[model samples]
Target: MTEDAWVPLALSSMIEVGTSAGAVVQGQEIVVWRDSSGVAHTWEDRCPHRGMKMSFGFVRGDHIACLYHGWEYDQAGQCRYIPAHPQLEVPKTICVKTWAVAEAAGMIWVALGAVPPPPAEAEVTALRSLYLDAPLAAVLAALPEGFGGTLAGQVPLVTLDTDLGTLRIGVQPIDARRTALHLTVAGPATPDTLLALATRSDAFRLSLETAGAAA
Candidate 1:
């Protein structure tokens, strides 16, 4: 994955304020969280102190504390406090690797290095995410139409036009044969339209999985 490209990490709704979630992008484990102020942050899932998975940690104010040893790291990924040594200033070196994260069109995006430009402004609402046991290429090839844009020459993101409205789908590769399809529909999606879109997406995923199995 290119450092300058943004990969879809998770739906914005997946991470509420004071909460965190784990995600895998291109086989790299990532921890995505939202602070009390509603800002989203992403970092490597491992804690520097004990190599613990930070996704299991809890969020307090603007920081995430490791569940193992109570080591707290601020949004910038720098260790700020240690329960074992309350009065001691944490060493600057005790920090987790952080990544640039942005929320737009109701989706969370993260970059491995330099943050890419945000997607074009649009009036879109998140629909749903579907996971498939298929390769990213096979999934993209199976798309009906209007899903032609590629981010970083690998991630497949497409905008589909429907009678109800326009919809966007971000294709995230989980591994060699698994993927997470994140969907966003152009607003304003009525209850009926939302249901229709979701049904269509589910059908598409089913077809893809069936084809993969047959192959």
Candidate 2:
């Protein structure tokens, strides 16, 4: 993973406001959450104090409270309040590691360091995400015909020109052998079209997995 490379972490729909989801990028656990104001954030899964997984924590407005000791952290990853020491002002040094997070094309993107520019503007509607048991290279090789354009920095994107509209497909590698496939239609799409695209995507994933298993 390059320092400036943006990896698709999850679908924007996966993390609702005041909720958090755990995602893995290059084997690193990440806590992806959305604030009440609809802003999205990503950070290292561990809390600074006890190294507890923050994904298991609860959200309160703009902050996330660790389930273990009720340690509260703000969006900046800074320890805002410590239940054990209410009168003490949390030290700024006690902060969880954070990453650059952006949402576009109906997906969440996280970068280890600086994030590149957002994806090109498109009237995209997210269809759904598919999980596959294959390497990123295998998944890319298995992409159905018609995909061409790339989004953010991830490559081998599939762009299908359907009767309804153009469909863009993005793939995120969960690890060496696991992947998450995200689908988005380029223009206004009907429910029927979205369903068709999802069905086709599932079939494509099945074919890839079957071939990998056979190989």
TM-score of each: 0.89, 0.88
Please give the lDDT score at residue 65 for candidate 2.
89
The prediction achieving the highest TM-score against the true structure is 1
**lDDT of candidate 2 over 49-113, digit per residue (tens):** 88889999989999998989999999899999999899998888999999988777778888876
TM-score of 2: 0.88
> In model 1, what lDDT does residue 33 have?
90
The RMSD (Cα, Å) of candidate 1 is 3.1
In model 2, where is the ten-residue run with the lowest total lDDT?
Answer: 144-153
Q: List the candidate 1 regions with Cα displacement exceeding 4 Å.
A: 145-156
Model 1, C-alpha of 30: deviation from truth (Å):
0.7
Model 2 off-target regions past 4 Å? 145-158, 162-164
**lDDT of candidate model 2 versus the reference:** 0.79
